[model samples]
Target: MRNFKAFGHVIIALFIISLSAWCHGQVELDKAPMEKAEKDALFSTIQGFVGNWWNGSDLYPDPCGWTPIEGVSCDLFDGFWYVTVLNIGPIYENSLSCAKNLEFRPHLFELKHLKTLSLFKCFRSQRRHQVTIPNANWENLAGSLRSLEFRSNTGLIGKIPSSFGVLKKLQSLVLLENGLTGEIPPEIGNLKKLNRLVIAENYLSGHIPDIFTALGDLLILDLSRNSLSGSLPLTLGCLTSLLKLDVSNNHLEGNLLKEFAYLKNLTLLDLGNNRFSGGLTLSIQEMHSLEEMVLSNNAIGGDIRILKWENLHNLVSLDLSNMGLNGEIPESIIQLKRLRFLRLSDNNLTGNLSPKLSTLPSLNALYVSGNNLAGELKFSMEFYGKMGTRFGAWNNPNLCCPLGAIATSNVPFGVKPCQQQIKLVESNTNGSDVNKTFYSIASLCHAPNHFWWTFPFIMILFLNSYIIGL
Candidate 1:
């Protein structure tokens, strides 16, 4: 019942977000006249990409006043309307789908007041036709553009423009899941005010430029799922204000650096599925603010007890699975009261399944499978009831689950239940039955014929004894 309520709340939140976006992109009005030159530039740019069939001016008495382009948003400045945000591609139901012969026009960069421009799935057909983004002249909008994004355009092949570095005012730049090849241009570091730079799921290869630390205000820097190789720049520790840093699923190789402790505000750090080797540094554990830390699938063999995990009081999700981590599971790990997910599977971890694990109130998913863990699990029935199959404890031959009084509704998978032991009673080895021997001796005294003879013998013996005495 609690889970259902939580799920329903999530659904409501998502609906609210969708409605907000729809409201922001739909019907917006400012009864001011738009500049003729900027309007022409906007019309030509829209016609070139969305294919001319949808007449812009004919849609309403004033497009900016009544019904505007589905994705384009405008703002009033000096009593004149100007395009501030334009989002192309099939994002909304009425959003203009890319024309079969879509093309970029020079007028796109002429919107002097434009602050945002995003293209989503405009070049989706990878095999049919491909297009490269403009390699130059991005400087025209450098003064006003604050955000730029290109998302999920598979046929968009080419190198990221080096000219983009001139956009000093740009606060966010996202290039997600495209076929853009080549290395990330170093000029991207020149954006001093950059807050977020997400360029993942591409064919990009090369070492991440050391210029990353230049963006002092960088909040999120994700470069996951690419072909990037070579050692990560040590200077990355200089981004002290960085919050989320994900370089997973790349070929980066290096030792975990102690300089990582400089990131006093980092919340999420994922370096999984890389070629990182050597010891897992304790410096990262010093980042007490880290909520999620994923370092799985690297050859970074290390003892799990190197750092006191209790220091990371804000830890929520911790994954150290599939690495060759050794030593016993540290008891101090149970100190993280807010820990919800803990995965230590496929490692060389040893020792007993501590009963204190059940004491963590927020822990829901705990996977410690494929380790050298031993002894009977001592968690309460309520713990097993809530966790169920989420408590993964498989492939440890020496480990067993408690039974008898405990129930199995939420038994941890892939481990055997403990067997009940019984003591055997000893049998008499002298080969005589006690009951039969006692009954045989008693019958001699009780039988009728035997009693008569016994009385005569007794009387004769008494007379003989009396005569001798007299």
Candidate 2:
């Protein structure tokens, strides 16, 4: 009876082990195969490429099975594998060239499950092909496509299609460094879900559309290095969620509107190299979240003292170079504890060097050249010497170095050493009056005469006094 009971226990353990192995094998076989329609679409798109590996053989018989295609990702949907992302370019480590004579294949749009598509340096091979992006067909993927990017396609030209507004599901759209021309379509505002829109380094013209105000969810809006003109629309302030706004290197003109201050979430604001002409707006002080504010190479002129620098505690870089700003460098600027770059060069500002500037722990670059600043620089010699050429205080004729101060070779190029002036006294007496005259001249040397006219008048007064004494 005991032997029969032990034999039954051993058989039960064997059965449990076999059941576990069989269940594991079943799970492996259950992985879905790539859908036939999607696989055919991918095959047709890369068929013209010379050395493509998507040849649909037993080795890569299944793109989502044991074998995987580079830069293509798939996911299981309705018990079948579907291509969800396509990154076609030389993005792989060993990949070198893109398709040489390739054209935009209509089969690419057949991937109904595609959610993301990125093509980098793939369309512009030798500048021979004049590829134009298809506009109306893009709406076909609007149900699933969330991100689309086309970068560095030199041959791409023509106006952006107004049909792009139909892609309501798109969350990001980037088309940078292309040969695209014409105006930005106002229909772009229809994409309410868009979080980022970058179309920089193109030849796009025309004024920015007021329809952009509808994109209240936009976080980054970059349209720099284009031919865009006209004043900024007041409707832009409606995008209160904006973090970075760059419209630099354009032909935009007119005064900066106070409505910009309403963007409380702004971190960076760059409007450099534009044709804007006006006083620096005081409304800018309301941007407490600002980190970098660049307005260089414009005609913005105003007193520096009007800026509320103390409120901008998180400010890191403030560039206003060649903006024609005037007035003294306010001491309140020292309150910006996080300031790293301070460029105010090529302006008409006049003030004594603020000694507090050197004490800021984060200061790295200081440019104040081509100004009317006067008086001795009171910062430590060691600090000034360490800055090298980054410290620009040249071109101020009235500004002079302290007496007997030794400057390094790296000191500002146009700065000159302070010269000590001596008053000459004339007396009628012969040898006896010589000692008294020398004493009178020596006293005038210690007198303060920073102004050019005061030194000559003091010399004449000393001469008259010495003659009377003799």
List CA RMSD, all candidates: 17.4, 6.9
lDDT of 1: 0.85
- Clashing residue pairs found in predicted model 1: none
Model 1 / residue 179 / CA error / Å? 1.4
Regions of candidate 2 where Cα sits further than 4 Å from its true position: 1-31, 48-59, 125-127, 422-470
My TM-score estimates for the predictions, one after another, are: 0.83, 0.84
The residue-level lDDT of candidate 1 at 448 comes to 38
Misplaced by over 4 Å in model 1 are: 1-31, 403-407, 419-421, 431-470
Total backbone clashes of candidate 1, pairs 3 or more residues apart or in separate chains: 0
lDDT, residue 446, model 1: 18
Q: Candidate 1, residue 6: CA error in Å?
A: 62
* lDDT (10s digit) by residue, model 1, range 1-470: 99999999999999999999877655443456788898889989988888888667555645566778888888888777889989999889988888867888999989888899999999887887788999777888999999999999999999998999999999999999999999999999999999999999999999999896688899999999999999888788888899999999999998988889888899999999999988878898779899999999999998989988998999999999998999998899899999999999999999998989888989999999999999888887788788877889899888877653223346676776665453322223464332311111212111334544575686577567545444
Candidate 2, which ten residues in sequence have the lowest lDDT sum?
437-446
Give one clash count per candidate, in the order shown.
0, 0
